[model samples]
Target: MVVAVLLGSVRSDRVGERVAKWVIAELESRGHEAVLVDPMTLKLPLLDRMWKEVKNEKGSEHAELKAKLQPLAELYQRADGFAIVTAEYNHSAPPALVNLIDYFLEEYFYRPSAIVCYSATPFGGVRAAVQLRSLLAEVGMGSIPTLQPVPAAGDALSAEGVPLTQQLAEKSGKFFDEFEWYMRALAAERKRGTPTGTAA
Candidate 1:
């Protein structure tokens, strides 16, 4: 399955990048296509209008923005599932992640999402994952039941996102297993028939 790994943090010294690297590596190791959707690199303008709204506008600025977003929209449309990597800020998911995801609606319908939460603290940003579950459901990619939370994210994985400890390496199996199951099930269903508001 092709899983878009949405890297949620864009801070200058963000550790979430390392966490995202681990998530991507894990997905690839499981034989899934891992596409990194970094908010920092995407540089999407804040949510004045959603992708669909801008897609219909005719002004020069809107045209340019549509060009920028069109490929991303197609990417989301083709993706089998999503891995949402996030950090907690004030006990909520990061704004960059929310903004990037909020730009598309139908592209996400019927696809599954896996919440991979991490933090510098021992709590592991699970608070952010809690909020993300609801947000992801609203966008139509409801999260899988098993959440993969990396506590003390900096120490859990190396700078390159290689697992430093045996425990961290072993913990990922079930998470990916469940994610793949849902991805395949929902994808097959979608192929049989498109959901309302989603493009086939």
Candidate 2:
């Protein structure tokens, strides 16, 4: 299955990178494709006054951002499911993510998406997860009931750093189980919509 993994923050020093890396490994082990979409590495100009008005047409002020958004749109459409890893900055979804979300709609429709939020408290950025869930639903993406909120965000990672008491394998096993279901259910739905063999 193609699972587009979005590290949904533009910050250079994001804490969720570890989580994303971990998820990628789990997904890959199950013979799935996990593509990373890092907003920091992909730059685009301000999108307020231009893209909305011109709407991806030629010579628009935000033509660059509009053009850049196509790949994201394409990826969203191509994937069977998605896993979004994001950071919380004051109990809200990051503006960069919000704006990019505004750039498209139906591309992400009718798919299952799992959310992972990390922060310093039990809230575990759950506040931001709530906001994101609503936003994603508005665009027609169904959120899986399962969520991973890693409190003390930076505390539970193991890519070469001092590992935690809980074995990484255990945590990954649970996460992957849900992801596998999400991918299968959503992919079945998508496949049903596709035509087979010669047109009837």
Candidate 3:
């Protein structure tokens, strides 16, 4: 199975990269294909009127957004599941992730997604996870109920851009287990032409 990781932090602290790499490694160790989807690596604007124009005007190009979209959507179409690792900004996920998720609708449908949220404060932006789960379901993605939240996150992060506790390592295993259950179930339900719960 292929698992695509959507990393949410844009900080140079490398929190997103670190978490993505580790998660991909863990997934790979278990014989699954895990990939990191870094928003930073792609040339995307924070807010571009281009995307707004393209969707409205016939034959207009979403050149800026398409660079990221075409590639990601292709990968997304083939993936079995996804892991979105993001740091909260002002009690919510980064705007980058919000936009990224919004760019595509149907490509993410009928797939499993899990969240790994972190923040400087307590609860590790678990509240955002709730809202994020809502959004994922709205976009036709099945969200895994089990999630990882690293609280007091700044204290646990070192200067070299590493997590101090690595608590997410353990949670990832459980997340993957649930993903397997949900992915298999969703595939079966699709074939059976029956709908299941929005959240798994």
Name the TM-score of candidate 3: 0.78
lDDT of each: 0.89, 0.72, 0.71
Candidate 1 per-residue lDDT over residues 82-181, each given as its tens digit: 9999998989999999999999998888999999998888898999999889999998899999999999988998889988878788877998899999
**Top-TM-score structure, candidate number:** 1
Which residue pairs overlap in candidate 3's backbone?
none
Runs with alpha carbons beyond 4 Å of true place in candidate 2: 49-56, 59-63, 158-168, 194-200
Model 3 agreement with the true structure over 126-170: per-residue lDDT tens digits: 877877888888887868989877676666555443556757534
lDDT of 2 at 149: 75
> Which segments of candidate 1 are over 4 A away from where they belong?
195-199
TM-score of 1: 0.95
- Residue-pair clashes per candidate, as listed? 0, 0, 0
Measured by TM-score, how close is model 2 to the native structure? 0.81
Cα lDDT over the full model 1? 0.89
Two-way lDDT contest, 1 vs 2, winner: 1
